[model samples]
Target: MASFKTVMKSGHPPTLFAAFLYFDFCFAIWVLNGAMGPFITETYKLTPAQTGFMISLPILAGAIMRFPLGILAQYIGRKNAAITEMSVIILAMIYGFFFVSSYNDVLAMGVLLGIAGASFGVALSLGSGWFPPEHKGLAMGIAGAGNSGTVLAVLFAPPLAQAYGWQAVYGFAGAVMVIPLIVMIILAKEPPDSEHQSFKEHISCLFTKDGWAFSLIYVITFGGFIGLSNFLPTFFYEQFAVTKVEAGRLTMLAAFMGSGIRIVGGYFADRIGGIAVLSVVLLAAIGSFLALTSTPSLAVTTILFMLCFAALGAGNGALFQLVPLRYPTNTAVSGSMIGEIGALGGAILPNVMGFSKQYTGAFATGFVVYAVFAAVVLGCLFLWQKKWVGAWVGPRGKVIDPTPAQLQAAGRLEPIAA
Candidate 1:
């Protein structure tokens, strides 16, 4: 394994820092509505189902926007696309501060928040693009760890909302957006990894079995991460009768674990294998989900959530370790497509939890359903790895050099194999 300093030397660290900061701020903005869910619910006297839908709208919109932004990044460059998206987010936040007076207006603001969500694929691709194959996982892990932005939203948004009203939180978010925007303009550079290709060539991942497979897995990893992160404050506040601010603080404990563990997951995936790390984390998630269905005491529930989030965060890192291996040339596009589909699962989760509580008087059914879905995806991963192991990747999804026969057959050495 390479030392951290060696890995830093292997890639453009300034751009990596810029990507992490860009993504960190974007992710915070993306979940801003969810962070203020309790306050919004009180302001509007919203029902559980309505609260769920309100939180999910941004995620759904973000998912729909991801692939298009990725495609645009391919043409305009990822750094440029990020700057453009951040500019839009600033405008959206301004609108939220001034115009979001009604529930309907808040819903509209949720859609605007989707602009921030579009940052994910481009951030990961740009950060890792300058790194060699062996170090891409760590590079991406560092960048993706920007999901810690969830911590920023959950920890700070509630108190800000409490002090200045939830609407004022939007103005604060917009003000902070400028910090990342400036850093991006000054420190980031377009990586030299992309190949100029036709639109169809760039989007070819859409037609592949492996692409959809990765998407399904992400539905569990990232989907669950975002869904639960957004909803946990609401859950703690309502379920445990904690004050809204305390709910946010408690939720922060769990989210902080998920965000920090992501880097470790990627580093270990590089040493062990992404497939193996993912398998273990899936089981951890499933078990945690099952335990949570019992709806234990507040302390126990918080601990279970922490464990569940850690698994989801690590799974996120492990899965991306394989993404570049599978689609080396067009990672930005493929990642966007996968992220778009997977985020739909994030949309599904809060709705399911809300409706379950509304209809059944408990959130247990939601946990059970997600646990079953994860188990099925885990099975599919096992089956898929058999074909993936040698066709494009090595044992357990490690990077490997192409065989001489494969090199000759393709008339060039493929980047899929190291």
Candidate 2:
């Protein structure tokens, strides 16, 4: 703790910036299919299942890679893990540009790009490991919010693809990422950890109650954020009968709010508290989700979209805040597990939405599913808050106040929960 404090006190602003970019690039790729997916679906003559699988493949690879990536980060250290992953992504995106000309080819590229997407797991552990419990919320929030790269994907890729072609857009992204990857490799440094755990012990944690709780909360926050970010543009195009340009514009605005609000969540977590903020935000998100229907009024729908994203984005920060509060000593393990599960949720939900669209022929059915899932998570939070938050201690060994009983039930109790 002393050593960690001394280095962090010295400032990790540069490392934080690099971490931010790492997240930005990974998220940008994670949802690449989001902006171009409709185009791909048309180009490939893909069935809904086929489209879902290809678009979500990166997410699945990212989920599977998380644990090994965590162990690798522990071995190579976070900075190197980041550099290697970013380098792999740059190479993958380039390959995608020139060689990917068929549905099978695009699927192959998506698999390779998963290397880029997996950086999220590495970054989450790395960012959380460096900061103290006191600063964890803000630190993780700023870095995690880089998922706004979804906005980057939507904002740039559509125009680029529309003009230069999708393949050309890949080339452009691949080129742009190289500069940041080089800068990150040179600038980011890992904070040190002395402890080691057996692989068996590390794997065992995933099945526990606490691990499940964190995973569930993360699904509500990150799952919803990623799933929606990935599929929202398509939703707008189908539902509102808007042009791709208008759809992309709306999607980008929501991603901006979602990504940007994470920092705000962090600041508040450092002050009034994570559980408090999380409670309000989750409730707001559930309401927004439920309120979102296929309404004729553009104004009502727009507010619902923005409000839903705002809550989900803030929830992303608050969940990480809860992670540090609950599992300070095991930030690497906790964060890795949390990220894996959250990303797995991301991979699954989009396809689920895709399937729902295929079957129901509308995004409203998908919205109902998201709303119900969020409500279930909210129920879990209430249960956890009631049964556990009072009994736990933070990484600093501080006795936190009794947070909402609902949160405790939601399984925010992880250093040992399940």
Candidate 3:
């Protein structure tokens, strides 16, 4: 194992830091509505279903926008793409501050927030691009830990909303956006890892079975993380009758666990293998989900959520550790495609939970359904890895040079070579 200092020496650390800050701030903005959900619901007199839809709009829009931004980043450069997106996000925040007067306008603001959410692929790719393959997991994990921006949103937004009104928080968010934008301009550089590819090659991952397989797993990992992170404040407020600020605080505890553990996940994935780590985390997520169906006490529920989030975060890191191995040249584009699909699953989760509570009188049904879906994906992972192991990766999803026997088994070696 390499020392942290050694790993830092291996990559462009300033660019990595810039990417982390960029992603962190963008993530805080992306889930701003979720952090302020109780206030928004009160202002609009929203039904459970309406609250779900309102919270989900940004996620859906962001997912749809990610791939396009990734393609643009390929042409214009990731650094430039990030700068452009943040510029738009700041303007959108200004719009939210002055113009969002009614439910319809709030919905429009949600779409605007999607612009912030589109930062995922470019941020991870840019941060890890300078590192060698062995260390990419840790690099990506550090960059990916920017999802901790959820903690910032949940921790600060509610109090700010309470003090100055929910809409005014947008202005505050826009003000803070300047900090990251400045850092990105001064510190980040376009990574040298990129290759100029034609449009068809850039889009090729979209057509592969492995790409879709990765998307399905991410649906459980990142999808679950973003979805539940957005919904948790609302869940605590309504389910346990906690105050809105308290709800946000409790959600912070869970989000914090998820964000912090991501780095650990990536580090271990680099050593033991991403597949091994992913398998453990997935089972842990499944167990946590199943346990949540019983509707325990407030403390118990928070702890369960924290455990679930930790598993999801670790799964996220573990999965991405394998992504570069699978799609070395097209990391940004392939990541965006996977992220796009995975985030669509995020859009689905809140609506499911909301409707479950409204029509069926319990959130347990939603938990059960998601757990089942995760189980199925786990089965698929086991099935898919059999082909993956000797083909492109070693056992447990480590990068490897295929042995002659392995190459022959994969039918890649010529007769003489075999």
Candidate 4:
């Protein structure tokens, strides 16, 4: 509460509020196909693999677009970059609403929707740059809370599709986009002192160890959260013989846990440290995924899924909290690259679930695979903590403010080219 007050005290409330709305509505469109999976699948007679690939296209497309969007945010400014991104989404929704008549048409729409997903770096930077470092975790968490848009999609899209046809969902999405567009025009502004690093320097981050590490972690955390959210409707529908609307209702509960509680995750990351919070989160995820391996009853599966989403949601907050601290001078670039890389999880995980089902007649193998991978990452993060402890203010318990020479010596700083 105090941190939030401190954040609001130092930043523009209108800009932050606009950033949240921009992210919220865009996110709803970003995952729309997943929410409408049953309708789309039934309409196209899509196989499990095709359905997985179709839902994953937007994620893959977003990943491909994010690096450029990240750089664009640096050059054009986050606000302008956001405007461009939203416009694409609106137009794509319009096309989906009126003209999408074939499977290929739907795939094209997914590519355009990737622009909305690419908004992550720009949207976060738009709000996060307005605040001081100490308040960054909570500020970003509050902004990132926009992920809750998943709940709205799952809750509304299925019923809307049932009543008005799945394609009508796009028209509604386009209409909603108008709300954020107007608000962004009225309120979104670049922070006065926000850094704008060179594109070459931003790209150079991809070669660094920290860059790769963050991306890998996000792959598991965000990938698991979003991938699972996207896949859950399908999982429930296929496994339990639930109606599309019923599956959506179930998926909404889990998505809500992941998206809504993320702010609390950031609060703890600010207090006890991001790495600390992530440590607990990853461990919990490992346990939950492992539990899912045993073919639990629907009741137990729901509990396990909720726990996994909770951990991933909180882990998302904690991870981003560490981002600015680790690469303070390159927040947008690092965030963009890390976000882009981590998003591969969204692209990859669903396919894994699909293939697992394709061959094994069950999704347990995918759960086990994720659990094993997360365990390996947990160990890596454990070692990373000791090395980064003296470098971060929140994690180290005091601001060390190490000199450039010291930072370089610790291998925690990269030389930016002029």
How does each model score on lDDT? 0.92, 0.74, 0.92, 0.83
* Deviation (Å) of 253 in candidate 1: 0.9
Q: Could you give candidate 2's per-residue lDDT for residues 1-418 as a string of tens digits?
A: 2343453564577787788888897788767877787677777787766776777787777777777777777666788888887777778788888898888888777777677667765676666566656677778888888888999998988888778877787788788888668877787777654246566544555655766787888888887888777777777776677877677778898888899999888767666667677788889987887787555466678778778888988888877777756554456666777888888887887788779778877556767787788888888877776544555533222326545663333323234533
Candidate 4 segments whose C-alpha is farther than 4 A from its true place: 1-3, 392-418
Error of 2 at 45 (Å): 3.2
Residue 35 lDDT in candidate 2 = 76
Model 1 per-residue lDDT tens digits across residues 1-418: 7999999999999999999999999999999988999999999999999999999999999999999999999999999999999999999999999999999999999999998998899999999999988999999999999999999999999999999999999999999999999999999999998888788778878878788889999999999999998998999998999999999999899999899989988998888989999999999999999999988999999999999999999999998888887777788999899999989999999999999999999999999999999999999999999988887778887888766665332212223422
Positional deviation of 381 in candidate 3, in angstroms?
Answer: 0.4
Error of 1 at 379 (Å): 0.5
Q: List, residue by residue over 1-418, the lDDT tens digit for candidate 4.
A: 4645667898787888888999888878889999989889899999888889988988888878888887887887888988888888888899899998889988898897788888777777777887876678877888888888889899999999999999999999999898999999998778774545555666666766777888889999888887888889999899888999999999998889998778888878877778888889999999999999898887788888998999999999888888877666667767888888888888998899989999899999999999999999999988777767765543532224667765443323565334
CA RMSD, predictions in order: 3.1, 4.8, 3.9, 2.6
Give the candidate order by descending lDDT.
Answer: 3, 1, 4, 2
Q: Which candidate, 1 or 2, has the higher TM-score? A: 1
- Candidate number with greatest TM-score: 1
Please give the distance, in angstroms, between residue 4's alpha carbon in candidate 3 and its true position after superposition.
1.0
Q: Rank the candidates by TM-score, best first.
A: 1, 3, 4, 2
In model 1, pairs of residues that clash are none
Each prediction's TM-score versus the true structure:
0.97, 0.88, 0.96, 0.94
